[model samples]
Target: NSKINLAANELLFREGEAGQFAYLIERGRIAILRDSAGEYQLLSELGAGECLGEMALISHDPRMASAMALEDTTLTVITRDHLKERMARSDPLIRHLLQLTLKRYRQSLGQTFPDTSSTQDLDYLEDEQQAMQRMRTEHDLSHALDKQEFILHYQPIVRLADRITTGFEALLRWRRDDGQLVSPDLFIAVAEESQIIEKIGHWIIDEASQARTRLASAYNGKLSEDFYVSINLAARQFPDPELPGVVQEAIRRHGLLAQQLQMEVTESQILENREHAISVLHNLQSMGCRIALDDFGTGYSSLAYLNRLPVDALKIDKMFLDDMLSDQASRTIIAGMARLARDLQLSFIAEGAETEQQVEALSALGVEHVQGFFFGRPFALETKKEPA
Candidate 1:
């Protein structure tokens, strides 16, 4: 019952496409051809019951030839998974030979063998495939980085007292080639797992520093602004010992005051390796780069670390603002946090403030800065320069 149907002269698959299975023609015929100087050269005519594309599953290579239906055709599909199950049940000597063949094949394909231990079970082959997939993803991301597909968006944080913009938070955006935007939540985790995030984090920091100069020049009205740009750092990115030196270099390269480049770290990010993170943060703080303890009151918000670390600001998580009006406890918690920020001499801003009433409430609670949709959505960074 595992049959696939194709209309007359239909393309079963094109050359260079990934193949997962072989096809046994149950009826009609198929033409196997290769592209030669822009025309398809017919290599063979496969009749009913002849197997096609069988070599693809064995080699894990792209289809070497294009396949088209000569007429209406039915195919019995034999999946790679079925073949893998049979291979798994084979003798150890057979499996060992297959491994050696795969190793040689990978070398021909310009790839080294994935890290497989000698004692691994037959499932190591599947793991090897996953390793290849991860490698491909990292390769694509590296190319995306070079192509400048990643961009920076800014959301202004307003000083509630005068309703003036003192600083902006830099948000990362990935615009795919198909014109769809990918959320950072989806891709950042992948980058972090592969350690590609370190490269990305350096890019963000450098961009943030350069942005400070342009913001001051183009929007030159805010001269003597002491404006700052906040950038979020991933937890895995902090362990690098050279991170502080790189940040210092960016500040100097952009002619930016170190205090103008703010690093935002979450409770979890710093908590991962508190001792190591704190040491690096200490070096950065001494260089005059400010740090913000971001998303306060979220998971693992420890006062112990908050007091211990050299943080200059506290960004209250948006969850409290969502129900502050209806819930007294939410209001109380916000008030307490604002008071704590004040007591610690730290700047405070409530995140996700969408309503005017919430802004009014926050203003009354003695919160100085607020950043959310009510003030401004994430604005696109314009590259326009003012006329001389």
Candidate 2:
């Protein structure tokens, strides 16, 4: 009896998975699918005000088909406990019929009954389904990269001190032939797990370098004065000994100062293979490339030797700013990170800022670099430099 909001194309449940809950669509449409010859066959589409997976309420039967939101949808969720309680109070004949119906439905799907003494088996089934889906997505992403279906979108980063646009962060976007945009939230994690991140990381650097050259041309050779495009590197990529050389080559090929490009890695990524990461960062810095520790202050490692990490900047994670105005503790922590950055002589950037008040709060805390909606949304760019 609670509402859940789902983004477009979000999965609600899969075929053959135990139905732990059902939903009534309050808005948008849902696509029901099933496997047919190794591909998904859309069986039907449900629209607003329709109930889904209601049969599962009567018995502990598995789902018969997959359900996915066709658009942004809001659904009223009906928990299993409520359904079970209602069933218990029903007439004996009705309950018996429901059990028989569910048994036949499972047999129709060629499913075998499992020992259901606990819910562990059901949980495992759901997990396996999700894993399989991710595997398929990974395959698609590999092909996407080859076909050039992927592209980069740049979001502006500004300096609070001068209120000037310094540079942009090169973010990834996957646009399919159908003109639908696949969210990075869905694919980035899968790419990271499948070890395809290294190739993606390289492509991003190559693209960002080319873009920087263009951005500089737009500024009549002045973009490099203080402007720098930041590219994110996965922690897993650290183990690739060739990474340093690869980045240095990109900088050399563009004939741009390394300071015009920055590489950002999360705090946790820095610790994934600390020794290897340290070596790579040193090599990058030696080549004049600036290094930024992204999502700063979120890692579990102690900050005892932060100075030894070979980083030139720290990006205060957005989680700290979510409540900076209402929570004094959040503001204090942000101020401390700013002070620490100053003492270490490393630059600091505040991310996820969205308002003037938030900007003022960050300014008072000594954060001079900030990037967020407060600046502007990311806009698409041509690989070649455009007139600024």
Candidate 3:
């Protein structure tokens, strides 16, 4: 469900009202109320990351209490359809347990719920808890930005033929106050869902540009003169009308050529809004920045549209190479991708080459570049004396 905001002292719902939806508090506080002797009495107050009115949604009954905003509040609405959709995927055993639990829950309130099949409250409840955790993480991410707790680590992109460092990919990392690095997988999706990724993405561009300057100076000509730092563009970033301007500003601010900065977008991300993605990529390309179609062959990479898009490179996804040694189909696919990249006059970068044999196999296929742990793991900016 989408989010809604309420001002202080606003009534969210009244007692005996039909439960059209439940709500998960993303921020601020809400007060639960009950009418007694013609006066509303407070039962409880729920702050950020709390869920309410779920029992009514679970039982298909009227709200047992009233709810009012204790302060300005941000809430995520949970509808009956949403609950039902979640239930459809729940396990049979879990569903049975939920049926019994919901039945007992209703009975405790002196009411009977006749429909046992409607019991999916367990999954709904679990999702509500997960939503609260996600909300908490999202809030922390927003604060992390203000705290400058985010970091960028550079991973080398190597030339396959000579195994020389040609460029690097800027990888994002979150370093909390405890100095423990948090994995991007845990927070990136939350940030994306919350739209905080746009701000975080812009920050990445600026940080990467600055890092490029440092890396160029520190490498002592070991890096290719045409060396570029590739920054991944989140799916949300492509539709942003201001994205081109943001990249242009970063390039200019770093006193670097646009070619020194590369933008990486996934195949699925591009397909999400093809027209808009094309327009944005073309705009960036016109500014002389490179655009790479990342994770190629993993999605609907139609040749019909591939020729039309403004892409400079094709980074073959790791899965193709992970099975290439044993799977002839994988080898054939890689060979075909190599030829396709050649035909399109695009740089072909094979990703996730961890072993010597994998590298040799990719090099034999005429894959020009490779990126993975075999070349170098991502390292901090200060350790820039050599490829890491």
Candidate 4:
């Protein structure tokens, strides 16, 4: 084995290079990349003790990817000639292991390739027909909304420093007729483009408020009266001048207090049309409701808008906190934001705190609240009492 050192950002291998050697990493990390339509796509990451270039060595073919060192790295290189020489002197079991590795590599390549052939062209036409049929299925989904195919789930946001459950965020999910659950990502965009977001947003407000009322009644003066429910507002629906009046009516119908409900708007939505969004936010706030800037620091002008808007809270974007343990810059930024929140008297929450390390870091940073899979996944409103 030959030892090689790579400097930070150095290219370890180029795509389509002849692979004569496989490598075992001894230090640092490498990112594997594939070229797609002339642009590089990050495929996977490899760290210490991980092997790379093995696919090419096993298949005796050109390298399928380009790899680059993320930091200074040390690697142990084993040439294909040496491996073949070892195989010649090894037992049948070693030869079988090498053959199995080649078979797996070919299987993986087959799974990654796109289907393109004369028969595949015909299959493509058939697939288009299937896609059109699926469009019809959307009509079923549209109709099912009236039948309650779409429902709201609540996930609690607890104050990490105090362990107090301050509020629940309402999340949407779809229960399809085939018993398959569809993610909101698949349908929410379609609904927004079709202008159905307004109806759905209103539905969420009514349902969540009613559920909050029921929970309060069940707890019967044992739980904090300030326990609130938060729902996301679609940007398109915000332009309606009647939104405050509509929400007020929903509050009256559910016998819920206005301050017990909050509205979360994404930073991108507010930054896109700051003047109009600020106006809408002010209107909502005037109606005795609280406003939160969701996914903060994720959009252009997010910090600028935060200073201008009358928002009560800032939910730090999850991506920033995800790498806090490994990235000093992320931790520094989050800690700085928490300090800014304290100075501004704005409540701060870190979303996507998935580990004990992340929780400890946020607590140390003085972030008031935390939410993520570490606490619990979103659950149906009736099931909220279950452990997080």
RMSD of each: 15.8, 17.1, 10.7, 18.3
Ordered from best to worst TM-score, the candidate numbers read 3, 2, 1, 4
Writing each residue's lDDT as its tens digit, candidate 3 over 80-141 gives: 78867666675434555565686777679776535433363455556555656776787889
Q: Model 1 residue 146 lDDT?
A: 81
Between candidates 2 and 4, which one is better according to lDDT? 2
List the global CA lDDT of all models: 0.81, 0.80, 0.84, 0.77
Q: Estimate, for each residue in 118-196, the C-alpha lDDT of model 4 and write its tens digit.
A: 2422533444454455455557666766977777777778787567777878888888877677888877765665557
C-alpha lDDT of residue 200 in model 4: 76
In order of appearance, the predictions have TM-scores of 0.65, 0.66, 0.72, 0.62
What is the lDDT for 364 in model 4? 85
Among these predictions, the greatest lDDT belongs to: 3
In candidate 2, position 219 carries an lDDT of 42
Model 1 agreement with the true structure over 53-105: per-residue lDDT tens digits: 88555555567679999999999998877687776665434455566675576
Question: Model 2 segments beyond 4 Å from truth?
Answer: 1-120, 217-224, 383-388
Better of 2 and 3 by TM-score: 3
Clashing pairs in 1: none
Stretches > 4 Å off in candidate 1: 1-137, 217-224, 383-388
TM-score of candidate 1 relative to the true fold: 0.65
